[model samples]
Target: MRSGARAVLALGANVGHRAQTLHAAVEALGATDGITVEAVSTIVETAPVGAVPDQPDFLNAVVLVRTDLDPHALLAAAHAVEAGLGLDRSTKVPDGPRPIDVDVIAVGDLGDDVVLDEDGLVLPHPRAHERDFVLGPWAELDPDAVLPGAYGGRVVDLLTRLHHGEGPA
Candidate 1:
């Protein structure tokens, strides 16, 4: 495994062979030269996390990858996987159904104050601390992981609670 920093990527799929897409995503990340998958959280059945309604349940998981790529590059690679798997991103939408959703949850050794935003990608994934779908698998992968927000230890704690309930929203 390439040793730079480990990043937790949250994967969610609600349509079209969710398990296969998740597995393919793992393969795709492994396919990248600079990124090697270290561990993957077990698949979690979750509810929608936003205002979207009447959508199918999602199959979500967190993947811990050891990578040397910067946050933007890693995000771009994830977007590429979604695109390669037929996720449409031509429109500006939110919380709706999709083929696959991949997001960078946390980065290894980064303090809570770290954040990134360029083009469309954001580090610590803007909503990770508040969403169970992200935090559930995230905590499952790294129970002691710190987030990029001010939630401190509260976020992970809340995650353990929400994880037992529904995803979000």
Candidate 2:
């Protein structure tokens, strides 16, 4: 682990004390070793997006962090934060309601070309640019944010394209 690699994390919740859980999750993340919380986007509430959709709205936010941990370690740290906040992954259904969700949005800068396609992790979050829940808050925190990948682009531009139904076909 080094000292200043930037990473983006997305937090969400729809069960229990949603806002409180998110806040705690952020704090816990900041407290973790090899990670430093930088900025957090204003939490936004939105309807769930996925196959299992009969659930309550979710409060989501984006977190900017300076981390020394590698991608997989960062992911493990995120999962730890999720579990500490009452998210039982084994019992949780995909897209189902949960107390917390910590998503690894992106690691490293656009020029770095940080791409990862390992067994349990994918860099730049394959669907980040397409989901407003992630982009909206991300744009709020970083207007110039550029998602790096085959389906990637400027955060604000992607959000605009999504609203216009102009996503890649």
User: Cα lDDT of all candidates, in order?
Assistant: 0.78, 0.89
lDDT tens per residue, model 1, 53-140: 7899999998989989887788888889889988988862688888888887767655454656465655556677677777767777
The TM-score that candidate 1 achieves is: 0.85
Q: Give TM-scores for every candidate, taking all chains together and pairing residue i with residue i.
A: 0.85, 0.92
RMSD of 2: 2.5
Q: How big is the positional error of residue 148 in model 1, measured in Å on the Cα after superposition?
A: 3.5
User: What's model 2's overall lDDT?
Assistant: 0.89
Top-TM-score structure, candidate number: 2
lDDT of model 2, residue 44: 96
Per residue, candidate 2 scores C-alpha lDDT tens digits across 1-169 of 5477889999999999999999999999999999999899999999999988999999999999999898889999999999999999889898899999999989886333355556368777877877999999999998998888777888899999989999741
Clashes of 1: 0
RMSD of each: 3.1, 2.5
Candidate closest to the true structure, highest lDDT: 2
- In candidate 1, list every pair of residues with a backbone clash: none
